[model samples]
Target: MSSRRSGISEEEINELISKLQSLLPETRRRGSGRASASKLLKETCKYIQSLHQEVDDLSDRLSDLMSTMDNGSAQAEIVRSLLRSS
Candidate 1:
């Protein structure tokens, strides 16, 4: 997709909105009615905490990969400089 808002056709947005609206009611019903609000909140909080940790782990891995790339680029530049000096 182009990096322009104008490039986003209405049909695509309507399709996405339709899918989201269809899913929302089912997801909302998961903790409704017989379930106590407190219990539902506690479960949701725990699930979000777990997801947060997973995201943190992935962020750390991405940081390591970026650092490795930066180091490799520096090494390549040094090699190129040495070659030019010779």
Candidate 2:
């Protein structure tokens, strides 16, 4: 598949991978690094999950606000029409 079709450029993917790798805990000894890396990965996963929830919440709130605005606009138009008739 081409990068254009994939919706993500190669550079962006690589950059994201690099960022995830950087989140891994660093150690001088290779044998003891696994525990730290695992813990860091878990933390990163939790953070990402929280971010997803936040985005969902924001989206819902924005939808509600837009709906409210539309209703208000319709009500205002009705009021204006009633005034003009009177």
Candidate 3:
């Protein structure tokens, strides 16, 4: 099939766009086919960044909880060393 964007076939591009649209919230996605590729890409970037931030927050919370556990686990031991060294 002839490509509309050089190298990448138009079908492939459309498929990628559809996936991107699915990732975005309904409020952000322009369902009318009027959204540009750049706009879609920008939204996807923001969405990914937000997800990364969420993951980081959850990881920090998990670390804090693990370190506070009284089970004498490996993670608690590591945290104990850091606290004593301070």
TM-score for every candidate vs. truth?
0.41, 0.44, 0.64
RMSD values, in order shown:
13.6, 12.8, 7.8
Q: lDDT per residue, candidate 2, 1-86, as tens digits?
A: 98789899988966665566565434222333334445556767887788899999987985675566655597656755765796
Which candidate number has the best TM-score?
3
Note the residue pairs that clash in candidate 3: none
**What TM-score would candidate 3 get against the native?**
0.64
Alpha carbon lDDT of each predicted model: 0.59, 0.64, 0.77
Candidate 2 clash figure, as a count: 0
Q: Write model 1 residue lDDT over 6-70, tens digit each, in one string.
A: 77776685565445433344335653333344554565567678889999998798567556665
| Model 3 ranges off by over 4 Å | 1-6, 26-34, 72-86
Candidate 1, superposed: residue stretches over 4 Å from native: 1-34, 71-86
- Ten-residue segment with the worst summed lDDT in candidate 3? 26-35
Candidate achieving higher lDDT, 1 or 3: 3
